[model samples]
Target: MNTIEFLLSRRSVSVKLITEPGPDDEALDRILRIATRVPDHGKLTPWRIQVLRKDGQARLGDFLAGRFTARHPDANEKQVAFERDRPQRAPLLLVVTAKVRKQHKIPELEQILSGGAVCHNILLAALAEGWAANWITEWPAYDDEVVRLLGHDPETDRILGFLYLGTAAEAPDERPRPELSDVVSRWPQTA
Candidate 1:
């Protein structure tokens, strides 16, 4: 597909609708290569990718369940199970971490934005490779314990997104979009 057409037609498949047969190791490596090709101001690659395969997903799910149970002592078994199964929704999960350098010449905000671009690029690359993907950062992404469970210091690293990849059970319908005239504006005045 051409660039314009691809951009216009791109949409995220829901995580629950994503099935198995995700990208293999070689394809995943290629996708990651493309994902990192975004703009970097100072050549400081301020992001990292963490691959959470099947077993890792289960482990993360268990960890999340434990954390949830601890925080919500009055929670029922169903709620705990929900937390435990959350990470297993997708076949593969890629955690994009924004490693912001406070003293670097490049601002911290730019570094964080770079991580966001990485997530978008991953989604695009997966779609181009005929795989459905979704970028998400739910409750676990913000929790300090979850960050530590992912093996990163919560102080310096932030979870930009959890990219879920797999085959789509069914194509998602296009949702309504904003009108260009309503969103776009001219910068300078023309009398």
Candidate 2:
């Protein structure tokens, strides 16, 4: 599809069951480069990418399971297993982190927003490449233990968006979006 058509038609496949994403090193590099082109006020480029392959996914799942077990000694086996299997939901995952620099003239919130834009770009780029992608940030993503395990700087506030990449077993349905009239408003008067 063309660029405009791609943007308008892009939809995230939540129930991803693809056999493989097959994003080779070159293709992945291109995707990452595109993702890095997001808006940055001070050009701080406050974002980091953590690629999690299949094995890494297992490790993450194990870590989460261990964490859950430690937090609740009395938790059931099913709960523990569920935590361990969570990461296996996706074939590959990319952890997008906001590496905020506090002393910068730019506000911390803007840095976080830039990180969010990076996540969106990752999703869009994957979509444009004929891959299924979804950006997810759940409780595990916000867990301090998980962040620490991921080696993010302790002093900096961060946004953790897990971008799942894979083939789509089924085509995604386009959801309703806000109309222009509902979202946009012209300025009432000029200065």
Name the candidate that leads on TM-score.
1
Stretches of candidate 1 exceeding 4 Å from the true structure: none
With candidate 2 superimposed using the best TM-score fit, by how many Å does residue 62's alpha carbon deviate from the native? 0.3
Candidate 2: residue 121 Cα off by (Å) = 0.8
Q: Which stretches of candidate 2 lie over 4 Å from their true place?
A: 15-19, 72-74, 189-191
Residue-wise C-alpha lDDT for candidate 1, range 73-94, written one tens digit per residue: 9999999999999988888999
lDDT of 2 by residue, 21-113 (tens): 547788788889999999999899888999888898899999999998998999999999998988777677899988998877899899999
| lDDT for each candidate structure | 0.93, 0.84
What lDDT would candidate 2 get against the real structure? 0.84
